[model samples]
Each structure stands twice: as C-alpha cells, then as structure tokens.
Target chain A: MISGPIPPHPRALLQDLWLEPEATGLAEARPSLKVSSSAKKKDADPTTRGPKAKASQGDLREDDPRERPPYQGNLDSEVFHLESGWKLLASDLCFGKGLDVDFLGMDANRTPIAVLALGEEDQDLCPLKLLDLKAWFQRNKELIRQTWMRICPELISLDLCRDLRFFLIAHEFSPSLIERLSCLSSFDLLLFRLRSLGVRGQQYWYAEGVAPWAHHSQEVSPFEAPSGVEAELLRERINTFLSRVQVVGEGLVGRSLDFEGDRFDRRALIENELVLELGVDQGQVWIRIPGIPDEFLLGTDEEQSRVLDCFLRSLMARNHPTWGSVPLGNSPRKPEQTQNEGKALGGRPEPQPREDRLSSSEPEKDSPWGRGNPCRSSKHAERSEGTRLSDEEMAAFFGS
Target chain B: MAKFFDRIFKPFQRHVALPSSLVPPVVGIASGKGGTGKSMVTVNLGVLLGSPRARVRILDADLGLGNAHLPLGLKPDRNLQYFFEEKGSLADLLQHSRYGVDVLPGGSGLSRLAHLNPSDFRRFALGLDSVLEGAAAVLVDSAAGISPQTLSFLLASDLVLIVTTPEITSLTDAYALIKCLALRRPGRGVSLLVNQCDDSQQGWRAFEKIRDISGRFLGIHVSFLGAVPGDPAVRSALAARTPIVIRTPSAPAARGLRACARRLEDILEEIPQWRKVPSYGRRLLEAQR
Candidate 1:
C-alpha cells in the first residue's frame, strides 16, 4: 500500500485535510505533525507536489467552519487526550506543510488516529473533505505507520497499519448526512458525546461514547454498532440467515456460536478465539480467518464451502494461541462483489429523540423492537361534503 | 389462604356444627423476624388480661419453637407433639400459670409442626372449640416469617399484632409482614407494637416509619398500639421463667405492656359482630386447605 512518498513537509499533506486560513495566528505549544526526515525526502520532491495540497485543501475548506470555528477563547482541546491506555503523539500536527489537522493520538492497539472538528454552521463540505482525506490516509498509511513506529518506539505490532481511524467532532449531525454515511459501511466512525460543565468562559469538559459500538477489530464482541436505523436493518438482514447458520453450527461441538447485529461468529468455547465469522455490510458477504487478516469475499456456495473448510483446517492445524485477539469477520454482503470497497463513510446523524419517538406525518414507522408492531398513531380522516336540509325540515326543529 | 378457603369452606361448612358461644376476641401476635420478644409480649399480654372476669389463654402457634410456657413459668407434660400425634387433645395439653394465664405448649424442634398439612390442621382444630370454651380472649403466638402455616393462624384471628423492635432490620421485616397481610386481605388493618425500645420515642419513631410506609404504599392502616421500652427487669423475669408484668409490676416494659393491653381492649371493642363470632377452628381449617 505504500506506493507513493509523502510531501517533503508533513504539514503540507495535513493542509490537504484540515486547512484553516483564518486560524493562522500561533498559540502556546501548538504541536506539529511529525514525520521522519527520510519519509519526507522519499515521498515529495516538494517542488512539484506543492500545488496539489494547495488546490484540494484550499477549494474544499472554503465554505466550512464559518459559523462556529473549532473551540474559541478559553476552550481547550485537552479533553480529547484520554488519560489511561492512550498516548498523545502529536497535537495540532500538520501532515504535508501548512495544513494543520487537529490532535493526533495512538489508541491502546497503537493505531494512529487523526481527529477533526466540524463547526456548528458552514459544514457543507465536511463529507467530501473527510472522504478525500481518508483516501489520502489510505494512500500513505504504510509511510505513516513505518515512520511513526521508528520515532515513537511503542507501536510494535505489524497490524497497526490496517486502519487509520478518525474522530469527527460536532455538536450534532443531520439525518441525511448520517444516511449517506451509512451507505458506505467499511469506514469505522464511532460517535462520541462530549459534555461541558462550569461557567461559560472557563468550561470543564468530558467525553462519553454516544453509540455503544465494538472496535473495527471485533475481538471485543463485535456489533461494531450501527445506531438506530442501521442497527435494525443489519439485525434484519442477519436474521434472514440465522436458521441456516444455526443448522451449520450445531455440528461444531467446542465452538461458541453467536450472532450480533449483522455478524455471526464461531469461536472456540475454551479459548474464546474466532474460528469462523459471517457478516453483511452494504449487501456484501465477507469472511476472514482470525490469524489471517485478509477479509475473503464469499462467492458461490461451492467456492465458499471450499475456502471456508480450507481455512478451518488451517486454523486447526496451526491453532495460534494469540488468535483470540483477532477481530471477527462477517455476513453474506451483496454477491461478494467489489461494491463494498472504496465506498466513503462520514457524517450521517440526524438529531433524534432518544426515547419514545414523537409522532410525525411519515406513514408508518418500525417499533423500537424492530420486528414488533408498527406505530399506530392517529391517522388523518377523509373529508366529506356537507348535506343540505330542506327548509321544512329545518322549520320542524325551529318551530317556525 | 384463598385457595385453602375455597377447598375447605364447602366441606367443613356442611360437616361441622358449632355453638355460637365460643367467640372471644382472638389476638394473634406475630413478627416477620424472630427474636424481637414476640413470645415475651404474648406471655405478658396473656398474664395482664387473664382474670376471673375475663379469662385469657396463650396459644403457642409458634409450634416449632414454642416458648410461651417458658416465660409463664410453666412446664407442660404434654406439648403439641402428642396433639399432632392424635394421642392427646389441644385443650388437655393446655397448662396454666400461677398468674391465671393459660399456656398451650407447642412441640420444640418438631419439623412436623413447622409445616402443617390441611389434614394436620383439621386434627389440631378438632380441639379448638374446647380450648375456646369460657375464654374471654385468646392470644395466639404465631411463628416468625410469612410462611403459609404462620399466615393461616394470623389471618384466622380477629386481630393481628406485629411485635417488632426499634432496629431498622426489625422494622423492615415488620413492614414486609404488614405488606403481606394487607395484600392477602385488604382493609383488614394490622396493629404494630414496638417491643425492646431504648425509649418511648424510639419505639414511636419505629412505629411511625412502618405506619407511614404501609399506609402510603399498601393503602392499608397500620395502627401503632404502643412502645415497650427495654428494661433490665424484663430480662430478669424471663430468666426466672415469669412474665415481667407478674415478676415486677413497676418495670418500664411492664407498664408499656399494660398500656398496649388497654389499647388492645379499645380496638377489640370496635370489632364487628361477625369477626367476634367466626369459628376459629373451621376458618383455620379452610385456610390450611
């Protein structure tokens, strides 16, 4: 995946993602994104590549962040730095040159994460900006991983380059944006809610996970949650194959067979290691072995059975003890095609009531329990023409 | 209890013929928790009420661990063991103290007495009429906890008094017992007597705690009879195998017991004619079914 070299200066690459021209003034300790000097030399002959960052970052960020720019006055971004099991590698770091991304950190898994905040208004190009930035990260993930590992020393694992997660912070999101984002399922976007307390000017802040979701690597019981509508659709799609899976799984004695949302997994009951997993994402069914990181897209029945059996026997033969830490792979997504690949995922949240849904003009809605009865709120009545009475009949009542 | 009544009402109602004269105010003393001086209160109340004008008999319905006789300073040659065996009668097993309080000794450590079947209850009630004869008031000392057997005895009585201490655990259990009684028979009010209190105020506070909760949640009245303050004389009297009231009349607990007895009399006076006249034996038999 490390096909091309990055720009001579990391800040220039960062400008392609998060360029804030108005935010030119310097502040105390605004850390820059660090890349090894060797990577800079190898990737960019900076003289030629300089124009691309200027074009994309400048064009995309023109309309955004007009209303509420990222944290003004006494507001600080320190709340994003989790205290335990996390390391803040670089703060306010730029990738290519002048483009400054927000805080950059590494999670417990040593996965490099880039964070960006969308302001309250003027966020029209957030989706496009994020998608393009994700493409940029994907193109240069190998360089970022290798260089960061050499400098940071803590990132020992080889699999750290598999994903570059993002934290896109905003007070709220629009529903259409959320739906559009859900259409592209591979991008790992875990939403978080931040609560601020204390006086207006000097506020204390804390962050909490808004949606209960599993990590990209489903080692921690994968639902890798899809909030509300998507969660329901995933459950429904997976349920369509539950009986068949159960039939196939019944013969396997020492396996922990279970289905959560769109993913069905079979692990050794003793080791709790992933043996086989089936899941659906945007109508694509992909399978992968725990020890083997390759997500094998399933084809025909004969091909699936052959590939699945071969992987199982291989897993049995090697039986790696560390396989328990491997992520769950899943559903028969659409025709095992390439449709799921390269599909961009970003903002798609509409502010919804967390409890009993309010009544709306929309025809019918699924009950909170998904398969339960449809909401039967009052419906609009049909109108009719008023009947006219004769003068004699009217006079009988009036005693005329 | 309803099912018990359903099964036995028709059968016993038709078979057993009864004279209406055996109705004295039946006061059942129960505590949801044990060791709150329930038996002591029963014995003291029995002694205070027992007289030539108004005779009182203590029914040791704490059948498994009956100690009413122990406090009354009486040893029974024949306890409920013989009665359950169908060898001796209930009235015959009744032993009287020097204070004129009659004591019915229940068999100690007898698991059979802990859970009485419908048939066993029927056999026991065979002698209830004789025991009730000429009695002005019958004080039933029921076993602690809301067991079906214990509940039958308590529900069958005209009045139920929950004897509890000032301790929170004791109050909670008392509340649980009151809740059970209120649910089983709504509007059938239960009285609470706080036993072994540090002071009168402590007892009153405990009573108010239970009364407020039971009245609010259960929608049934929990009457506070009175609080018996703890006194050293009460322990001495119990050790001497005599009720505190008889052993030391000036004792604080004895005085509180007397006051509660007076209150009991006033409450019993308002009892309906039907309640005073129900055949305790047949009702218990029905409840046991």
Candidate 2:
C-alpha cells in the first residue's frame, strides 16, 4: 500500500500474472482440489456477485439435467404426475412370486393406481399386460398395501383391494386396442404423444383419454340449428290458430299445405269429385271454385271467414241432407237419425226436383237453384247428371 | 320414504271412473312378429260379429303395410291417409262391406301418422273421436311388432288379443311382446290366440309353455282364447279373396273363429251394463281435450 502504483496490489498482480496455460496446468495437476476449491468459494460468499452470477447461483441448474433424458419411449413416470395428478409411489414394484408392476402410484383421490407403459411396437401386448397387472395386483395385495403405506403414511389406513385402479399408458394406441379397452370399463386408457423441447433429454408430454375416443366412434346426426326467435314465435302462433278452427271433412279428405314450397294447391273433393281448389302462395290464401272464373284471395279476417263458411256449408250440404233440417247451432240430430237420413238419401230412386216443388211458390227461372246458380247450369247438370248441388241449393239447405 | 311407500301402495290405487257413453269395448289384435295373420284374425272376427244388431267397425291401424281390405275383394276409395291430409272427414273413410262390417281402411305407405308429432297426433285422435261416435265395437288391427305406433293402439284398447303361431320363433317373440306389455301395464289382462297349429293338442301345449314362462318371469296370467287349426281352406278362401269366416262358414278355421266370437260375445254380455264405457277413441280424444 506504500508505493507509486501501490505495486498494483498483490491480488491484482496475481490475477494478471496467472495466464491460461498456468491455470490449465494447475487444474490438470489438482482436479479434485480445484473442484473442492470452487465448491468452497460458492459456499463462503453469500452476496458478492453480479446479476448474472446471482441469477445462476440462486438455482443450481445445468443447461441439461442427466436424469431427464429425451422420452423416446413412453413418458417417464414424472410426466404423468405433472399432467394427470399421478403421484408415483413406487417403480418396478415386485412381489416374491415373479409378479411385478411397472409403476405404482396414487391418484388425486388417494386411490392406489397401477400403471403399465407400452411402446407403440408393444401396443399389441396391451391386453396381455392388462391381464398381468390384474393378476399381480391380486397376488400381491398385501405387499401393495405395505408399499403404499410406506410411501404415504397418512393414507396408510386406506383399503388397497377395494380402491385399486389400473391404467395402461402407451405411446400410441391402435384403433383395435382402443376398442378392446373401451369394452373393459374397469381400466383407464391413457395415450401419450412426445414433443421434443430444446434440451437433448427433455420433452413436453401430452396425454388424453383413449377410451372416450373409442366410445364415441358412432356416427350421429348433427343437431339442427334453431330457427330465430321471431320465426319460431310466428310458427307457434300459426299452429295455435290452425288447431282451433274445425277442418271440415278432415279425415275423409286428403289435402295438406306444402309449407316448404313457394306455392301449394289442394283440391277439396266430395263424392270423389273436385268441388273446390285451395291454393297458398306468398302468405296468401287462394280459393277457386270449379265453375267460377275469378280466384278469391282470402287476405283479411272477413274474407277468410266468408270463404271458410262457404266451403264448410257446401261440404255439409253435399255430404248430408239432414244438415238442412237441423236447427241452426243446435247439436246435429242424434247419430241414429243421421244414419237413417243417410240411408234414405242412398235409397232414393229419383232426385227430388226441389226447384220444381219451389217453382209453384217462386218462379223457377229466378231461383238460383234452377237457373241463376254460379256453380251449376243446364250444361253442368247435363254433364254431372244432377249429382252436384248448386250454391243456391246449398244455401237453401243451410237455411242461410 | 315417500317413494318407498308409493312403490308399495301403487297397485292399490283406484281406477278413475269413465263415462258410460265413452265405454265401447275396443279389441286390439296384435302380433309380436310379422306374418302371423293378425289382420286375418281381426277381419274374420269382425265379419263374425257384424250384424244390424251388433255394429262392428274395423279400424285398420296398421299405418304401414295395411292389407285388411285385400281379403274383402274391395279396394278402399278412401283410407286413413286422407284423414291425415285433412281432405276428408273420418266418416268419409268409412266403407261398408257386403259382409255388414264397416271398414276404416289404412293405406299401405301412409306412415306419416306413425311418426306424428304430439299436436298432429291429438288432431288425428280427435278425428277418431268423431268416427267412433256410433260404433258398438271397434276392432283395431295393429301393425306387427312392438313399435311405438303399435304400442299406442294396444295400450288404448280395452281388450288385447295376441295372435301367434306354434312356431318356436313366433312363440318366443310373442313372449317378448307380452313381457314388454306386462312391464308397462302390470294389471292389464291379455288373451292369447294360437293360430296355424297342427291340432288342438299342439296349440294347447304351446299355450301352456307360454303361460308357464309368462307366469314365472313376468308374473302375468294370459287367458287362453280358443285356437284356430291350420286349414287348407283358409288358404283357399284367401285365394278366393274372401274371409274364411264368410266364404267358407263350415271350414275348420271358420268354426273355430265362430266359437271364439261366441266366447267373446259371452264375455261382453257378462260385463256389468254400467261398466260399458264409450269407445277408446272417444275417450282418448276427450282426455286430450
């Protein structure tokens, strides 16, 4: 400390004089001594390092750890613990009778589990391995209990036989193996895929349930997407209204609205003859009578009601004459009387000239039933042989 | 505890009373497996029971593969398909046969009604209500097997006739059908009719076997309706396009059918007059309402 340059301090002079060759020679001459010296250095100094030194010193890590080699085969036991809550209790557990388990572990529920790992090439032997695991567990239940107790003393009192579960872990499972394992619901199947990290012996392991994939192999129709709320509401309203109105001759007639198409035509028939045609297009109801030239569009309530009333009255009059005799709104005659009327209608030998009978009271030419009917005329009477009822006749029959 | 008590006491629950006007006996004819002549039995029975005094309406409820009209030599102008399409009333679908039986025909491919949604089914059932208004007895010929459509008809009927042959497969399937029915309706009684048997003894043996199995496994007693012997005349009458009971009244199968009809008539008479309710269709429609 007493000189022109302080003689460069003895430590600084020693550091500058020591070259790479001398350091190499010294390390070679005393390898153990040098290691022990470095170890001592690390232990003696607690807080005298740069940021990098402190960071490296805080955790004793190597760029690569020897224990974690690249998992070329099935995953190491620790990967399962990290991924699926499998705590390895023991590895290569053996009983005295030549029975051994690959790995013995505990699940998150503290249930003892036996796992067997198979490489892709050994996937065919899964069933054999499963059988072996089951046999080993059966043969060495007491040994497994003791081993579990030794590893986890807190769970020592757990029932090993009742709570034991078995799992098969493999690199890749064939579809056949998965199908076979799916049927064996007692065993859990885990499939692993290996991803190489930057390090030589390290990997990222992914595992999934193979049984679920096998169980859900059946083809299913995709769910139909729901119609929007407004469309559904409109449909519900239409259905409600249709349910209320009486569909005349509903069971005897064969007419349906083709809702999927742009236009639909339904021909209403009485006695196997088309009497009225109904068409629906662009939210409009079209009514067409056989002899009428104009198509009536039922757009409003009054129009719809009028058309429905006309259609029902025509049908009633064509099907039953007793409809005219029954008082308006009173329950139609008893079923027996209706049957009698039907019989009488069928048995009549000649058509009653109701127009002629009314002609004495009112001029026949002025009567719609005789001459002025829109649906029936002299030509139509000649063609239909008088089977068809005129609109005026139907009206007279309906007492309207 | 409440569930346990309910399980124990469920059988003791009283049946709700039904109105007398809605109580016409509905006889459902069914076969577990196809091609066992369920429709044949239904048609013959209808013909045997048909009269001015006894109004018999045969409803061919076989929505698919209905051939009830074939043996009658009459083509149906209208069928249940018309009812579903809302073109005709149920009354228009009613056809009168020369044999005095009223036939409500079912179409061959009219399977839409078989898969009807609840609302459409209700409407169809209401249509049935009007058709069944004046019927004294309605015999429903249900489609073969235990399909939901067939089961609905069977469940709604007052009496069920299970028709089967002496063949082993037929007997086995018939037992399966009976098992399903017994599981669903424990207290409902079923009658068995063995057809195509070589003789009365063979039919009786088959019936006994089924009765034993049903008693042991299902704990249900099956009533033995009379058996119809295998007769070449049945085939002959079928070839002639006529019901065996009508065309060949003296045939062996016809005699057996007459006996069965007589027995059914006796049973109907034995029922208390007050218990005679309206038709099943009417009751079903009323229930829906």
Candidate 3:
C-alpha cells in the first residue's frame, strides 16, 4: 500500500483487467457450468419436478423453521452476543453489505470469540443482541486497545472508513446503548452523517407486485417518511450518530488533517459548521470544534477506515451475546423447544427467487455482475443472491 | 418446482442462436458540396457490404435535410430525431432496412444534438456506447458542406471517407475539405473515393490531384480508398428503391464499393490497437468539466 495519489489511468487499467480474455472467458464459462449442472441434476433425479423432490430439496421446509437451526446452537441463550452493538444502533440506520463481509468474517476478540452472520437471511430483521455489553467493554478496555494495536499496526495511512462506510440513522435508540459503544477509544473519522430516515412497509409494490427493498421494509411499499415512534426513535438515533462521530481521537483526527506539506497558525483556525480546516502539526492530528480556534490533523481516508474497523470489533465483543441477550455462558436450550419460540417466525426469511445473490455473497464482484445479462439464468441468479449479500456487507466495511 | 422448471428451460427457446459479432465499422460518407452522391454512395456501399452477421447502421447525420433512406426507397419507423427526443434510448430508434442494414435516419433535430453542452454530451456518449457496442460499423452520412455539426461527426469517426465526382468543381471542393481537415488534424486519415466517375482514368486523376496537393501543401496523407464507376444501374436502383448491389450484384458501382470496403477493412486491421478516440470537440468539453 504505497501512499502516493492513485493515477486516473488506474481506473482504465482495472477496466482492462475486467475485459481481458481470461476475465471474459471466465464470465462466459460460469453460465455454461450452471446450465450443465441443472441439466445434470435434472437427469440424475427422475422425479425432479415432483412435489416430493421439491420437499427433499428443503427450500420450503427450511423456510418454515422458527429456530436458529442447529448450527446457531442456542446463541440466544449466550450471555454476550457480539451483534448487540448493531442492535444498539437505530433500526433504520442504513447499512449496506458488500461482497467481502460474507467471506472473511468479522471478529470480536473475546476469549470465546464469536462471528455474526448478518447474512442475507438475517439482514432484514437482525435478531442478534449485546448482553452486559457496556460493563464488558469498561472491564476489558486494555484488551480491546491491545487487540486493535495488534490487528492494525499501520493505521496511520488508511482511509477506508470515509469513502466506503456511513450510517444513515433509522430511529433513536437507548442512550446507554449509544453512549457505552460511543465511549470506545476508536470510532472516529466518520464523515457525512445523513439524518433522515425513509421507512416503508410490505404493502408497497412495484412491477409484478414484488417488494424490491423487502429486507428493509418487511414488504415493498413506496418510500415514505418515518412517523410517530419510528420518527422519534430516528431523531434520537441521528443525535447519537452525530454525537459519537464528534468524539475526536488520535487516529480519527489523523485522517482529516492534511500534513503532506505547509504550516499555518494553529489558534487562528476556525471551524465553519459544515467545513473543518485541518492541517498536521508535529506528526499529530489536532482537533478544533466549530466554536473553538484550533486545527485538527486527521490522517487520510485510509487511516480513518482502519480506526473505525477497530471500534466496530471492540463494540461487537462487548455487546452481542446470544439471540437477544441470552448470554453464551447460559445453559443450552432444547432445539425443538427453541424452534417453537424463536422470533424468526413471521415475515419472509428466504430471499425472493431470481434476485441476484452476488449482492449478498461476494460484493467485491458487484460491479461485473450488474454489467450484462449474466443473471438471466435463474440458477446463477439465485445462488449468487443468496451468498453474495453477506460478502457485500464485509466488502462495504473494509472498502467502506 | 414449476417456477424452477420454467427458469431452467427458458434459454433453450431460441432455435438458431448465433454468437453476436462486433458491430459493422461505421463509415461516415461526407463531402464538401451537395449533389456529390454522398448519400447514394453510402446507401449502395452499405447494401454492397452488408452480411447476415455484419449488419450496417447507416446514420443520416444531415441536419434539416436527409435523403439516404428515400434514395434507397425505404422509410424508417422512427428517424434519428427520436434519439434526442428524451423519451427513448438509441436502441428504440434503430430501424432495419429490407436489405439487412440498420439505418439511423437523420433529421433537422441533429443540429440541436451538435450543440449539446458538457453534461448532455456525456449522457449522449453513454447512450451512443450502447448503440455502437454491437455494430460492426456505423456509417454516418454527414450533411453536404462542412458545418460545425458535420465536422464533429467527421472528427468523431475512425475513418472519414470523402466522396466526390470527377468534375473540377467537385475536385476543388474535395481538396478544400482535405485542406481544412489537414490544418486541424495533420496526421489523421482521410480517404478519397471518386463517386460517379465516368472512367477509371478520370477517377484516378481526381484522386491524384487531391492527394498530391494535400501532401505537398498540407503535409497530409490523403489516400485513394477506391472509386465507384458512374453506372446507369445505380440510377435505376435508386428509381426502384433498391440498392444497386441488391438489384445487380455484378454492377460496376457495387463491385467498386465492395472493393473499397475490403480495403478499408484491411487498413483497420493494420492498427488493431487503435482505440476509438472520442471527438476532439467532446474532449475539449470534457477538459473544461
């Protein structure tokens, strides 16, 4: 990762790679494989079109299950679920998933570390929650700091947080949740916090009566402003989001400060509400609030992304425990019993047929997927959509 | 299961699917004056070279007046004016000729397109990319006289094929076009095709006069691409609303056009890496943006 400015030609160079014979050949080859696979599977199963065969495929049966199938293992019963940090954020806070998130999983550095699958299936109504999240972070402050130091040795030159990631507040949440998480040493360098929230329900239908943003709106209804409790909650969420962003630290400040060259009067600096003039001083990023006469040296875009990543990890470790705060330390519940009681009951769990899966599984590959008619094949479309959405989230975070 | 079955079986519907080849090379037929048979050459040339796989898209770029389709005895469903009508993409305006060629009928509205500002130009280019992506070539039949819009079309193209008859007036006008283009782009390619030439000697004389003068004075290389014989079959084909190539395959004009197209193809193959350079006027706008 050299730090000089990226040449404009690099965009064209990347385009060339996508168009190269090897790349195009691979793209063409994929559909052929899928076409053959379906043909083969059809040939192998004489009753492939029968109801029994469809049942055996388990698409419907799996959809009906009210539990976090066996693999999830009473994560609801856990004392600390890493996903609580996410729940603490406003429900409407807009977060998009890119391709990488589904692949290289997010890490929470506690002893029995956990990974949350904010995968496509669970993304719409994320059920994971944090338990004793606040106390745990306060107790393990040193470990959290050490973890970030080890993971990101050169966090000074990164800028992933600014360009690739942002949170649009959905609704306000408990102050304790926002305050405890925001208090972390990291989570700085966040720019462009859009305050408005547009909410819609399932009744909203477009072509063919299908809800495009089904995950966010439960059903696809036309976009409308949030109201009543949702509106109030959204306002608080915006406040907290803005408050958490204003907490300036060494790494976050480093991202905004232009220290490449020149020097100026530090005290003469004035923060015009919308714009902040930042410059570097003695290899440090200084912060000046709107009313204050000081300048902050926030590092570049790359540095800011790395610091935010650290904050997310620490927050995940303290907050998320099990299915809705059932700390992982608790005794496991019977699978059948939990199946009858879990909240993943109502609302569609599976993605719609023919929707692109690459948007979920491997988001880094998002650009190429949208270019042509490659998604015409239902098989490729379904598989790509199911897997790609998670990868998109991760890619968004890293690339975000 | 029924839904899955339909999805899996859908692609098999096409009985004779052919791999799509690149679009036909767009050869814009332009000249320095009217009645030079620019439209006649473009129509007949397109008909002469068009194949089932390599489809020709003859764009009538003439502003206010266009006769490429009429001379060829065809009427398009929607002319080039529809391309700028804000309602449709270029894809919707494409009309296929009976002879297996696609024609973008030019209209007076084209002048407005020529005056598009920077943002409009970028949007226009993206639409053009979709239109040009599949065509082997786009033959822009530019209006007679080098107007600003006509110059834009000429400079934007990969090859500027200038058509002129054997008369002294035609030769001088053709030479003037070469001189104008030479002053602007001293190193660019300019092909000369003698349309309505009574004989090979006259055609060669016209080509030589233009080529020699441009080379000596302007230091420009004006190539003699090929010459079309002034044959009665071309007039009869126009009267019948059919291309000479389709009406009489052995016609001297048809034969000459095919040869010219082949030579143009060979020249294109020589510079396989020569990318489609955007119009210089458009580039200037982009720089400002």
Candidate number with greatest TM-score: 1
Chain A TM-scores of each predicted structure, in the order given, are: 0.33, 0.31, 0.15
Descending-DockQ candidate ranking:
3, 2, 1
DockQ result, candidate 3: 0.02
**Candidate achieving higher TM-score, 1 or 2:** 1
Question: Residues A1-400, candidate 3, lDDT per residue (tens digit)?
Answer: 1112321121122112222223223344212111111212222232322222332243321343344222121111111111111111101010122111110111111111112222122223321122222234346545534553244332222222221111211112233433453333232111110111111211110000011101221111111222223334443543333243434321232222211111211111101111122222223444333222333334555654554444333222321111112322344244454545554675434322223452356442322111111222233234334322233323422344
Cα lDDT tens digits, model 2, A48-135, are: 2222133224322332333422332212221122112234444434443223444556543455666555544446766666667666
lDDT for every model? 0.54, 0.52, 0.42
Best by lDDT: 1
- Native interface contacts retained, candidate 3: 0.00
lDDT: which is higher, 1 or 2? 1
Candidate 3 global lDDT:
0.42
Better of 1 and 3 by lDDT: 1
Model 1 CA deviation exceeding 4 Å by range: A1-400, B1-20, B272-276
- Poorest 10 consecutive residues by lDDT, candidate 1 chain A: A376-385
Kindly report which residue stretches of model 3 are placed more than 4 angstroms away from their true locations once superposed.
A1-400, B1-25, B108-125, B271-289
